[model samples]
Target: MSKRILITGAAGFLGSHLCDKFIAEGYEVLGMDNLITGDLKNIEHLFGNENFVFHHHDVTNFVHVPGQLDYILHFASPASPIDYLKIPIQTLKVGSLGTHNLLGLAKEKNARILIASTSEVYGDPLVHPQTEEYYGNVNTIGPRGVYDEAKRFQESITMAYHRFHGLETRIVRIFNTYGPRMRLNDGRVIPAFIGQALRGEDLTVFGDGSQTRSFCYVDDQVDGIYRLLLSDYSDPVNIGNPHEITIKDFAEEIIKLTATDQKVIYKPLPKDDPMQRQPNITRAKEILGWEPKVDRAEGMKITYEYFKSLTPEELNKKDHKDFSKHIRK
Candidate 1:
């Protein structure tokens, strides 16, 4: 009998990709999501596979595990600022109650669990290249605080479970990642730029556009996640690309690739925005034997092509001006 793994938010960008990975590897994969931020179209292709099963359920509520599970990948939180801000209470509930529920399930079944964490825990970090050791400088009451604090609380509870119950738990602090199947209007930088370029609109830059961020392609992120799941690490590990680029430069690169005549438009930066966010993946390299394989330019090109496949009307509807408003330089 093949091993079974439960993936929360299986309809999400990363979660969908994980579903594909696990199914391709011959595991019985159960994908669960509420379809709030996740879409059914993302996982539609997997319906034909015998090993894949989809469940329309919210992780914030009690989740019933169907069979004996070998692993559980908890990635059901509201990820984007626009998403979490719009659904702040749900975000908190998912992070706090949802995580606790899943941890309980892990303990009940003696399954190893991996919680999907974010670099936001290192809120507006004081360090240049943030490592797992650097405690963040986050604002608890700010708008983004709903997501940040929720994730911070999630990590705290995860640690408690690890120490008290000895539940085999893994936490990954993921940085900015983009790829195919990502919602064009989800408000992340890559999709935002691609959407604007495809629509022949201005590529808006926030603040002075000098704020820098590093991006990891979806494939590389999945690779790192896979390695970490198979490894023996219990602490939170950072999984992201180390390459850094300014928002302005990143916009320009997208424009150049898409050949869009769009110009740059500057806007006020959002409150408590991190000026720089680059991951220190030394632990990933040393422990997981992983490093980001795809560069930003290459990743952007692939992502742009995916955006280009959408109809102009579909692309226009997702115009995410406010999402980028906060992260502007």
Candidate 2:
């Protein structure tokens, strides 16, 4: 019998890519998503594949896996600020109740589970080049807290499951990842800049644009996640490219790449924004024997091409003017 794996949020940017990876490896893949922040277009290409099966269901409710399972990757959370703000309660429910529901399934099926954690847990971190050991300085009541605290709570319970239940669990702290399939209007920096540049709109920069962030390509992120699932790294391990860049310089690069004459506009920064973020992937290197091979310029080029393929109307409807300053409450 072939191995079967369940991937929550399988229609999402990273989740879709993971579905491709697992299917390519010859495992039977069960992709589950409620299409909340995820879109069907992202996974439509795989609909005809015999090895792939998709379920339009929310994991926050009960999940019923039909066949024998080998792994469960819990990645169903509203990641972007735009998303969580608009659906704060659903975001919290998915991360908290959804995770608990998945853990229950994992226990019954005896499958290894991987919970997708985030670098936000290190919120506005006091330490630079954040290592896995640094506890975060996060605002519990801030606009971004709904998403951040939910993830923090997710990690807490996942660890408890491992200690108390002896159910094998893995946690990966992902950083700023970008690629195709990301909603152009999700308010993430990469897609926002690319969308504006593509349409000849001024690129918005928040707070002088000096905040630093690292970017990891989708392929590299999936590579590290795959390694972690096969390995024994139960604690939360940071999986991201350690290459850090300023928001100003990043926008400048995008403008130049697109050869857009659009001006850079400044906006007020959101509350409790992190000044710097870079992952310390020393553990990933030593344990998973992995590191991101794609550089920023190369990754950006690929993502830009994907955005260029969309029609003007599609771009306009999906792209918003500017939501960087706004926070979800």
Candidate 3:
């Protein structure tokens, strides 16, 4: 019998790709998502695979998976600013309550669990090129606090389980990752710029666009996560590209790639937005022997092609997901 694993948020961009990766690796994969921010279309292609099973359930509530489970990847959460700001309570619950439930399940099944953390935990860092040991500077009451605090709390609780219960746990502090299956209007930089260019609209750059970010292709991110899961390191590992670029330069690159005759527009930066986000991946290279292999030009080209393939209806649709039913009272 093949090893069995459960992946939450499996219908989301990264989760869906993970589903494909695990299935290709010959694992019996179980995918769960609430569709709050996750679209089933991302994972619909895997519905026919005999090794794949999907559960349309919310992990913030009870998560029950029968049979022997070898591993669990806890990835259920609203990752973007737009999604988390709209559903703050749900976002908090998924990271806190949802993580607690999954931790309990992992302990029960004796399964090793990996939590998906983000660069948001670093907030607007005072440190350059964030390292694993750098304590973050975050505004607990800021608008972005809902997501950042949730992830910070998730990491805390995950460590508690690892130390107290002796449960096997892995944490991946993912950085800016982009690739196919990304929602065109998801409020992420890569997709947002691409969407504007594709529509022949001016690219929107916030706060003079000096803010910097590093992009890691989804394949590289997944590969690092896979290696981390299998490695013996139990502490948090940063899985992202260290190469950084400013927003203004990135916008110019996007404009050139799309060949759109549009200019760049400036807007006020949002509250608590990170000014610089470059990961220090020395730990990843030394421990996991991993570093992002995809260059920005190649990765951006692939991402642009993915966005260009979207239908006119999808491109124009402001909000593709309906959160009415998922919003809890």
Q: Which candidate is the best by lDDT?
A: 3
Tell me the TM-score of model 3: 0.99
lDDT of candidate 3 over 219-242, digit per residue (tens)? 999999999999999988999999
lDDT of each: 0.89, 0.91, 0.93
lDDT of 2 at 210: 92
What does the lDDT read for residue 145 in candidate 3?
A: 95
Instruction: Estimate, for each residue in 229-302, the C-alpha lDDT of model 1 and write its tens digit.
Output: 98999999999999999999988898899997899999999999889999999999999999998987788888
Winning model by TM-score: 3
The sequence of per-residue lDDT tens digits that candidate 2 reaches over residues 285-319 is: 99999999999889988999999998888789863
Best-to-worst order by lDDT is 3, 2, 1
Clashing pairs in 3: none
Q: Model 2's lDDT to the true fold?
A: 0.91
